[model samples]
Target chain A: MSHGVHDTAQARFAPGARVRVKPGRPERIAPMHLRTPHYVRGREGVVARALGRFPNPEDLAFGRPGEPRILYHVEFDQPPVWGEGEVGDTVLIEIFEHWLEEA
Target chain B: MAGTPLPESVELLDKLVAALKRRGVLVEEDIARCQTQAERAQPETGARMVARAWLDPEFRALMLRDGTAAAEAFGVAMAGAPPLGVLEDTDRLHHLVVCTLCSCYPRAVIGYPPHWYKSAAYRARAVREPRAVLAEFGTVLPAGVQVRVVDSTADYRWMVLPTRPAGTEGWSEEQLAAIVTRDCLVGVTLPVAENARIAA
Candidate 1:
């Protein structure tokens, strides 16, 4: 049910906004083409930049027009992406609008 | 075994292509054309882009701002492919790109992904232990430089714009590009000036 925010070509959550990956769909039971990695699910990060409107790859893979979604470059710290000491390393993952919520 | 067995995914692709062919949506010529195009998609385009960017700050800004446009400036076709994202390597930060889910690379600019890049080990360990991965590739970074791993998860493909090695001030673009290998753009290794290598 966490899929109704991307109404505009350029939807909510701009760059520099703190956001968390949404754990919307259950991956194990059904066949889904998801771009959000499980390691980042429900984790917090900052939006590095908006990558303009793109058809949801999940839908495109299934041969659908996939109503455009705003894609953003989300940057996460290395600690939560994995359990490790502070290495000062960070990760940047491209996530669609529907998979993210303003933190 | 004669060779490694193809995964079920390969069979699925075959089935999909067959279905499309049956429906007249795909043809043999299309596949041949694709193969030809794939042959042309080498890392040389990316290397030339990096070399030009190293010498021209304006091109570097354009590359960072709009990677597809920069690639197009090099005459690489950018018709239906996804946008490109160029991550710059600075004195304090290094970028290593991985597709955790699958191998999604900037094929238009940098050719196909390497075998190791698509392996499950690289995909998993790159995010979990990037520093270790770089070291295995013989890239030992100083402690001060931060390691940044980029996951090419969605629509935009990623490549690294490596820093120019010192002592190449008067080098031509072709000479500069000659040192930029596919691994350098992949962020596993760096382009070292021959003099620096010899001196070290």
Candidate 2:
């Protein structure tokens, strides 16, 4: 396992943490190669697992040495995302630490 | 008759491969070996692994603990492949896989991903409206069963070990393996005994 540029201690969130995706416009973040999806912005989910620290892909796309960021497997209730039509479903999205805030 | 022309993208890929070989970034023989390995590592390999896990408790534990190692033990070549994670589905919880960023899949184990798995609509709706997507795939779960959609967004590639369907008891490993389809491994559908009958 190749540890990227940072350590686990620098990680912002841990497993089981309740987090909300930070809402932002893609244009405001960068002009090209954004890793965080648009639909997930502003959605709330719990951290299912900590996927360890890795190079921030957003920076890596530009051939820069991306500073490592903690990634989490965030699980969201289906009803909240897609409404009552999907009451029994849950969706898990892998998100970086930068895009998350305490719920 | 003249052979059909290759797609522009494929032509470009061939050029890129030649360029890489010239630059010493890739070796032709190594690429050939990897291609052979990929061909051997088909969806049937994944199905076999699922069947073995269904039959042997120790293998199941090992599979859950370290998927890549378990795959290697079964002679599945995983060289230059992303790490594998096997999600076991129980009666209460189910699993689904998507690559929200791109079409990242466990190609080494399950071969090439289906076209739908690589579609933009799937990537968008799978997270936003998974139940609807699964419904379109003809996999309707009960109200009590919780669907867990896994995004293969990082270095880890995920596959589901769907719960063995009922009425498969006393069946041989090969018999059980017949029912485990690529969709079942991906969690889009469940393995039915009747499907096994048709396949057999």
Candidate 3:
């Protein structure tokens, strides 16, 4: 079976890569429909795993070709996210490559 | 007979369904069959997998490695569904599943998701304040144990394999499976031996 929407010759981020989520504008203010969570924007996390390549849902939702984007499982510290919790706790999100930058 | 009025979204969904029917995008018979399959789904499928994993180390390894294949080996059909990933809860770590974008779930294995799972509050709070969310569900983990909230996005779906509760040693697989509740699989609660009495 096909692994994902499109096959990429190489993955953008390898496992354990440190990356930061781009702090894009909120959906109400943004021009495009973004699938990344608002709360996670601007946050730093580690690439937990490479979840393969898939069509960018943000573009796909609008009936565009979507192209292929590398999806990574990123894990963030819970305390940094929630502001008062177990430090060991973490939140993991599947993010598209476009939403990430090397930290 | 009178009944509650359908929500605007429901009405919109009806229109969408009617449109799909007119366009032949969906057949009535197929919709009915799908509804039947959804209704027939049970948490027992996940329970069986968890029970087997608990009993056999090799099966547990397989489940951790490839969840979909392990599930199919046990006769759970996963056709047309996204890939399945099983998260194992250890002594130091716990895993919770949520879909912030929408209510994407492992319907093939766990059946229909609970209504609360699809709520905006859950989607928002799960990523922002998961500890509080879990506390609201009566799952207060110890301070030292780490909680990991996994977002189900794109082509992968996740389920939690909760750590086996105490006081159930030497129990049969059937007995163990009895205590494995849907909430446990969702990572919101732990299976208790007390509840197993009723489940048995």
Candidate 4:
């Protein structure tokens, strides 16, 4: 079994904890592959739940043994994500811990 | 015929394929076989899981607990696929799936995504304005019902366990499965029991 970071660390945020997606792209050695969507960048949301840790996809794309990152189901209200929408409607996204911070 | 070099992507693909074959790591037949398998596991494959979940309580619980095992119960192979997450739909909630960055779907459950799913327009508007997109698909949820747009990602895939339509009391699993269309599985539309009548 490929035991890695995902296996060792506890998730920083729990379900219902408010968090924010880190804004802007970080400089990196390898070309960035897809991870978080730009639409949700810098957006505020609550942790719907924590999911299993998997290899960081950004590193995986470059053929590296990417350390596992904690994945979370983050829920953003429609009003904040878009300029207009029903108040209660929300967009749920899967974000890794690295892309998130306590809001 | 050989006047111009092949398009860069095609040329690169040819070289890559040649190298893989030389290394005995891949073969042309494998690609064909994968395509065939993907085509076979279409919406119908998911319909079976949905219908069984609707008809059997224990099965529904099992499906919710472990989706991959649930697929295995139906003999659907899920090798090399991302974890399958089935979003449940109730009177108060509806789940819509999109890949804002790219088209990442539960191909094992729903087969290849439709052409429209990969369009840039869909990628942009789906998360921004899902209600309008749902309206375009002819599905209009009454006010107060929360619409949760599920953004499927590179490592995770999603599908909706659509709220089973009313007046389908005695329908067989096969008949129920028949109504679970691909669009409904995507949550763009709801399953319809067009022929079922509510018994008086």
Candidate 5:
């Protein structure tokens, strides 16, 4: 196991894995280290493109050069995301592959 | 701004400003300058690079790849600006920029970041809930395009090079730069009016 920055994070990779946020509660099993912005979280969108092999930010920020992980560009609907009657705009985030699963 | 910070040393600075204001040692205009309006003089080098890139695509790629290097390619010396990065907007991904901590902006390209860039509302909301933030800016993306909120922190500052709007193919570089407003380049708003200056 590469001692990268994301080493402390649990469940490095698995699609459609049941995941839940710790929600300031440390005891719960948090499947993915969530990087999805609070706005688009839970708002469903398809995976547009998977950008592979990028340094995990948890490591990159601290200068820990660990193994590269898969990154995905996740897209969400504008209306569904912002709610109805709002100007429609899709939201996309660059998330590590480990954070996602078969929804 | 990301370097080691000594405690809240800024409290001392603020107290000094308040004292000066009480004594009428400084005028409102002076305070404005020291507060915000007194940013580093706009780097002419960056302005010229923006104008040049409006005319050339090869230069555009270079700007995206090595931001500082590309600026110098057009004789724009990036002396005062902090290390800068260019984030390009594409058909699938739309970029919205913010500096959550302090205003770490790409002075080499679009000049000082707007006031909204540093507002607490913008900072707290941008990274937390991007969809709501973009709505505040009045930019509704197409049904399929995804909005990616890139935070410009102390170490890495970002500038959004908006996709060149259509209907300006035959326009000159000078004409194009006129449309590239500071807000547009920052990705807070879209470039409008083929040849008109972006409304401040």
Candidate 6:
């Protein structure tokens, strides 16, 4: 399925980078199945933070593969994104390392 | 006998919301909280963060690092009745939120979304091409700034707190909030002032 971010270079993820979940407390709940928003998956984003890991949402959402990966905060710019007429300069989103790659 | 035809969607949605509450997906207290905030809530944390970033390079970096935490530092509660997630607006990526299935939302933080937000036209078309969709809503953006679309599903909800508007060399938080219209918070419109279209 086409995920839909026009300028892939604007993302922070490396084309093929293996990142792990660095877990934490209530702040870092892991092994959870979650429906990672479509706009954020497989996009290149900088490793903004190493927020400790917990149950990943994918597992928690569907009740399968409960293994949690290190979560990283990723930020994206607006101009290159929506293709003209945006308010802010950048957008920030949280995602696991498994979702990143070199653009 | 009184004769009246109610908009089926409104009546149905109200009933569905009630049913969701009855089924424990949401509670009376949750509904009450959403109401109170919807009537009066504004994006204090987002505005303050943008303002501080405008003045401080470091805080902007922090905002980029952890939006929820950065918002919390400014005294905005990161957690809400329903979990809240931050969706930033970038140059290329525009953000719009919708819930076709239900009004799954981060009610505690940004407050209840407007009635139009959950509409089918918004939900379907927004995912197709958000910029065009926003334009239809009269939220014409400047030369730059891309639009990214966000879907509010049963599992997670989203909100877009537009960046601080221009003008007002120095405006108080309350004054700033005044200009931060409901449209701005939802990413449907931009908050403009000063040379930024003189919204006042």
Best candidate according to lDDT? 1
List of chain B TM-scores, one per candidate:
0.88, 0.90, 0.88, 0.87, 0.70, 0.61
Candidate 6: tens digits of C-alpha lDDT, residues B54-145: 45667667665555555667665545433345565665455666554445655544555566666667765565556677778787777765
Q: Which stretches of candidate 4 lie over 4 Å from their true place?
A: A1-9, A27-30, B1-19, B195-200
Q: Which ten residues in a row have the lowest lDDT in candidate 3 chain B?
A: B1-10
The per-model DockQ list reads 0.56, 0.54, 0.61, 0.62, 0.13, 0.08
Residue-level lDDT of model 2, residues B80-185, one tens digit each, is 6766778999989989899888998888679978888998898877777777888898999866888888877776788899999999999999998899999888
- Cα DockQ of the candidate 1 complex: 0.56
What's the residue-level lDDT of B63 in candidate 3? 88
Measured with C-alpha atoms, the lDDT of residue B125 in candidate 2 is 78
The TM-score that candidate 2 achieves is 0.86
Deviation from native of the Cα of residue A91 in model 5, angstroms:
8.6
Q: Which candidate has the top score in TM-score?
A: 4
Instruction: Give per-residue CA lDDT, model 5, range B53-118, as digits (tens).
Output: 667888877877667677557554466544456677877767887655456677655555566776
Model 6 / residue B5 / CA error / Å: 14
Candidate 5: misplaced stretches above 4 Å? A1-103, B1-51, B74-81, B194-200
* Tens-digit lDDT string for candidate 3 (B14-112): 999999999999988989998998876688888889998999999999988788888788787777767788899988999999998888887777888
Angstrom error at residue B141, model 2: 1.8
lDDT of 2 by residue, A21-75 (tens): 9987876755776666676789988887776677778778889888777877788
TM-score of chain A of 3: 0.86
DockQ of 5: 0.13
Clashing pairs in 5: A4-A66, A15-A101, A15-A102, A16-A101, A16-A102, A89-B141, A90-B147, A91-B147, A92-B147
lDDT score, candidate 6, position A4: 16
Write out fnat for all predictions, comma-separated.
0.88, 0.69, 0.71, 0.76, 0.19, 0.00
